[model samples]
Target: MFSSHSKLYRHASPGVQEELLALTSRLRSVITAQGVVRRTTAAIERSQWLAPAEWSALQLEAMRALALHAGRRVPYYREMFARLGIDPRRWRSLDDLTEIPVLTKDEVIAAGERLLAEGGPWLRFKGSTSGTTGRAMAGWRDRASIAFEQAFVERQARWAGYRRGERRAWLRGDPVVPSRQADGTLWRMNRAENMLMLSSYHLTPQNGAGYIEALEKFDPVMIQAYPSSVGYLARWLEEHDRNYRGKSLRGIVTSSETLGEAERRIIARRFGCPVFDWYGAFERVAAIGTCEHGHYHVMEDYGRVEFETNGDGTANLIATGFGNRVMPFLRYRADDRVVLADPGFACPCGRSFRVVERVLGRVDDAIRTPDGRHVVMLDWIFSGLFGLVEAQVVQERLDEVCIRIVAGPEFGHREEQALLLRARDRLGAQVIVRIERVAQIARTRNGKFRQIVSRLSGSNETDV
Candidate 1:
C-alpha cells in the first residue's frame, strides 16, 4: 500500500505509524478541551491578565524549568549551568535568563555531535531551517519540544476558526501533490477531517487554476498558505479580473513570512475572504498572529521575545519557547526583526493578546552595497514596483543584482521596464541590475518564497 521511496516509513510504516500519529494528535487536540470553545477560553484566560510584568515572570519560570531539566539530563546544559554558577532551583526570573548566554545557529550545529554521542537522554533528531540569513542549518528537536510545538499549532488553528476535527487545506512547506497507493489508486487518508496539501513552490498560473478547482472540490472550511504564495494568487486573480470565490472557505491563513499590508489587502479583495497573517519562526514555534480584526497579536502568555541589539540600535530577535520541554529553546536568536506596536491598539474582537503594528523583514533578507552602505528599507523597493504579479531580487555580488518577475500578459513591457528601472534607480548607478523573465521562482524547503535574496556576504549586521 506504500511506495518504496516514501519517507513516511522513516518513523514507521505508512499504515501503522500514520494511524498512530493521527490518533495521538487527535487525542491531544481534545485532551485540553471537548471542543474549540473550551480550548479558546483557556487561551483567552491566559491573555486576560497577561501584562508585560506577567510575561516577564512566565519567561523566567519557563527558563527555570528548562534549566532544571537540562541540568539533570542534558549534558551540555548541565556543564554550562555549572560553569555559570547557576543552581537549577535558584534560577527564577527573566533577569536570570540574562545570565544564561544566548544560543546561535553555529552553537547548535557544533553541539549536535555531542547530543548524538550522549544519545540516551538527549533528544537528537534533525530539524532543518533556513537560518536568519538564509543559511541552512539542521538541528535537533526533542520529543518534549515537539509536544509543545503541537500544542501551539493546535491553539493557532483554534484561534483562526478551526475545530479539532474540522476539514481544512494545509498549504505549507511541503508540496501539494496526490498521494497514490500501490495499485496507483489515489491514496487518501481521512483523519476524521479533510486536509488537502498544496505545494507553495508550484504556484504557477496553471497550477493556481487547479488549486482553485481543488479548493472547490475539497470544500475545506479554511485555506492556509505562505504570504508570498497567497499574495501571488491574489495578484493573479486581480490581474485577470478573476475571483477565487470558493464557497466553503471561511478564510485564508498566511504565515511563516512577513505579509505586507498591500499584499494583505489585495488578497482580501480578490479572494473574497478574510486574510489572517501569522508571524512565527521554526525555533520559537509560535510568536504573533493576526486576529480576525486584522491586527498582529502577540502570544505573550505562551512565550517571550527579546531583541538583542548591536549597541548601534541594530538588533536580532531572540525568543524563548515557554511551552516546549524536550528541546526548550532558551534565548535562541530568531534572526527576524519587529517594530513593537504600542499597547493602546485594541481590536474589537476582544482577544487579550496585544498587537504589533508590523513585522519587519528577516535579517538575512537585507542587501549591502560595496561602499559599506546598507539597503535597509525593503518595503520602499517593493512599493515602487506595483504592477508585478510576482517578483524576486537576488544580489549575486556587491555591485550586481538579478531581478526576476512573472508578469501577466496584460502587464505591458513598459511596466516591467519601469520596475527594473525603479529597482536600479533605488540602488543607484554603481549597482548592475539584470531583469530576467522566469516562469517560476525557487522557494526554501518550507515553502517561503523570499522576494529578495542577498548573496553579497561579509556584511552580516542588520539594523531593525
Candidate 2:
C-alpha cells in the first residue's frame, strides 16, 4: 500500500502532489475511520454495560498477551526479562509486569534497534517526539497501533458530540501554510478530510480577527487545536467582546498539551461549546481523553497505565502499549506527571475508562515576536541538535530573546549556528537572538522544566 501510494505521489506534478497527498491522507483516514467506529462502539458498550470486574479481566488478558509477545519477539524486553529473573510463561497477570523495570526515554534512546521486534512481517511507520521536554525520542508504529489510536481519538470526539464526516477547523503545530506568505488566506482547505488547516505560527493579536473571520466563514462543526492556540483565540474574543456563538461549531478538541482550568473555561465560554482535551504522545504508550461530563478518562484498552505516586500527591505515568507489536513499549515511563483521580470516583457520563484528575506537564509561555506573532512550542527551533543536553528560550522583551543551551562535547559553533539560523528563520531577523552556553537551565519551583518562557506582560505560561 505504501509503495503504491509513493509511486503515485512521485509521478504527480506539484499541483497534483497536493491533491494526491490529501487523497492518500483521506484514504488512510477512511480505513482508520472504520476501525475507529467499530472499536469505539465496542468500547462504549463494554465501558457502559460491562461489570467492573469483567472489564478489569479483559484488560488483564490483553496485558498478559502483550507482555508475552514482547518477551518472545522484542530483543530488549526478552533480555531484560531474563536478566530480571522473570519468566514470560508465568506472566499471567498485570502484577507480574512489575518484574520488568520501567522503560525510560534514556533507556529507549540507548537501546536503539534492540527495542524493535524481530521477525516482523508487518510494516513499520517511523515517528518521533517534538522534544518539548528536552528529551526527544524516536520509535516505530505498526498499522494496527495507529488504527487503535485513531479509534480512541474518534471516540473522544464522539463523546464531545462531534459526529463523523463533520467539517472541522485544525490549528495545530503542522506547518500547513508557508511562513513567508503574509497576505490573504492564512488557512488552506483539505477537501479530502473536510478540514481547514490554519497556521499556528501566524496567530497574533493583530491578525487574530483574520483567523476568527476564516473560522466563521468555514463554519466547521468542530475545531481541533492546540490548547495554547485556542486559549489565545478565546482570550482575544473575550477582550474584544466578540462571540462565536452562532457558528456550526459544536465542540473544541484540544490535544498535545496540558489544558489548564482557566484556559478550558475561557475556550468553552467563548466558543459556546464543550472543550475536550486529549493527552498522549507519539510513543503510543498511553492515551487520556476528556468526556462530555468534563472528566479525563484513560483508555485502558489502548494501553496499560501504571502510576508511580510522588510525595506531592502527583503520579508519574508509565504505560505499556498493546497494539504496537513492531516496537512494543512495555512499562515505558512517559515522564508526564498527572493527578490521579480516586478509584471510587465515577463520571456522570458513566464510561468505565479510568479517570485522570489532570496532566501536569508542558506548561510554557508563548514567545511574542517583534512582529507581534505569538509562537508556542519553540523546541522545533532546536531540532537536529545532536549533542544538546537541554535548551530553553526566554523572551525578556518583544524584540529581545535569549536561548540558554546545555551542550555536550559534540555541540560547538556549527550546531550553535544552526540553532541561531533556525531561530532567525522563525522569528524575524530584527529580533535580537542571543545564544548562551550554560551549565544548566533552571526549572520552575515545582521542579518542572519549561521550554519557552516569555516575560512579556499578559503572556501567561500555558501547556502545549
Candidate 3:
C-alpha cells in the first residue's frame, strides 16, 4: 500500500478511509487469489521436501534460464559476456556464474537502462534503495517477480502459523497513520486483509499506552513489524511492568533492521510469543528467514546466495535472484554480512536448507530525543530524495541533529529544506536539524557505510 500521508487519505473520514483501504487490498489480492502467488507458494512448500540433489537441479535450471535471458536481452550482460569471450547460454553448471564478474552498486548505476530486458514493460515496478551506504540506486523488477516474492513472504508467515485473512498488525515503515495525528489514534483498520496498520513514525513513550491498547483490541494472529518499532513497544511494556495479553497472537515477525539479542529476548518475553527475525533487501537478491527451530535458514529456493569472506569473522552477502528477469541481478554483491554456522550443522526441523548462526545486517544507532524518545530508522528522511548521492544523520546532542549529505547534481537549498522538514516531522519541533554538505561520507574501518552515527559515548539508552 502507498503511504497514508497522502492528502487523499488524510482528509477522508475514518470509516471512508477503511473502505478505501479495503478496496485497495481487494484489487491487490487479485495478484494472489487463484493466481501466480498461490501456485508458487504451493510449489515452494513442496520444494522444501526435496533432496539436496533435487534442490540443486531445480536451482541450476532457473540459473541457466536467467543466464540465457540476460545474455540475449540485457545489453549490460551481453557486452560483458562478449568481452570475456564467455557464452552464458552454453554454460553447464553454477560455477560458470562465477566466471561473470560480480556486479557492484556503482556498475548498476553507470550501466543504467542497458541492464533492462529489451522488450516492453521496461519498468512496471521501480523504487530507490534505502541507500544506507549513501549510494542509493534505482531498482526495477517485472510484475511477475514481485508476485513471486510475495509467495515467499506468505510462506514465511505460514512458518509462524499465519493463515490467509487472519488478523495481523503491521508496525513497519508504513505511515498508515499521520505523524502528527493529535488524537493519538496511531493505527488504522484495513478490513480487506483484516489487518491493523500502525504508524511506526509516531510511536513515542507518551503514546505507547494507546498503541498497545489498539493492538490488544485487534488481537492479531501475527505481528509483522521492524525490530526498532517493536523494540520500543517491548521496552515500554517492561518499563511499565506489563506484558502483551493478546491471546490470539502467534508470533512476532521482525525485519528491516537487525534484531539485537537484548531486544529479541525482551520482546519475546513481554509479548508472550517467539520472535521470528527475517532478512531481505531492496535489491531482492538474498533472503534469510527464521524457522520453527529458531534457526536462520538461507532461503536457497528464493535465490542463489554466496558468501565472500570479509576476514572479520563475518562474510559479505553475494546473491543472484531466480525470480526477476526484467533486471536480472546476477552475482550482485550486497552490503550485508552474516555469521555462518559450523560445518555439517543441521536443524531438527527436517529442512536441508543451509543454516547460518545469524545475520549481522544493519546495526544503525537510533537518534535520541530530548524528551526521551529514541527515534530509529532515520534513513526514512532520505526516502525518495533525489540529487543526493549519500546522507548520514549524526546526533551530537539530544536536542540537535546534523544531517551530513553528499550532494547530487540536483541537490540544492530547496532539497536541503525538504530533508530538514522530513526530519522535523519525526524528531518534532523541539529538535534542531542542520544540514551539512560534504564531498563524500566516509566509511568505517571495515569499509562499511553507516546511515546514522551517535557521538554520545557509552550512552546507556534504554532497551529500545
Score every model by TM-score.
0.65, 0.88, 0.94
Residue pairs clashing in model 1 are 144-326, 145-326, 173-446, 176-199
Candidate 3, run of 10 with poorest lDDT: 455-464
Candidate 2 regions exceeding 4 Å error are 1-24, 27-49, 130-132, 383-385, 409-418, 457-464
lDDT of every predicted structure (CA atoms): 0.60, 0.78, 0.82
Error of 3 at 105 (Å): 0.8
Q: Distance (Å) between predicted and true CA of 332, model 3?
A: 0.6
Instruction: Answer with 1 or 3, whichever has the higher lDDT.
Output: 3
Per-residue alpha-carbon lDDT of model 2 for 337-425, expressed as tens digits? 88888989988876777888998766677788766777877766766575787888899889989998889888889989988977876
Provide the global lDDT of candidate 2 against the true structure: 0.78
Expressed as tens digits, the lDDT of each residue in 179-280 for candidate 1 is 221112112233544565554434545555666666667877777787766676788788788988677677788776667788889988887888877777
Q: With candidate 2 superimposed using the best TM-score fit, by how many Å does residue 409's alpha carbon deviate from the native?
A: 4.9
> Alpha-carbon error at 76 in model 1, in Å?
2.4
Sort the predicted structures by TM-score, highest score first.
3, 2, 1
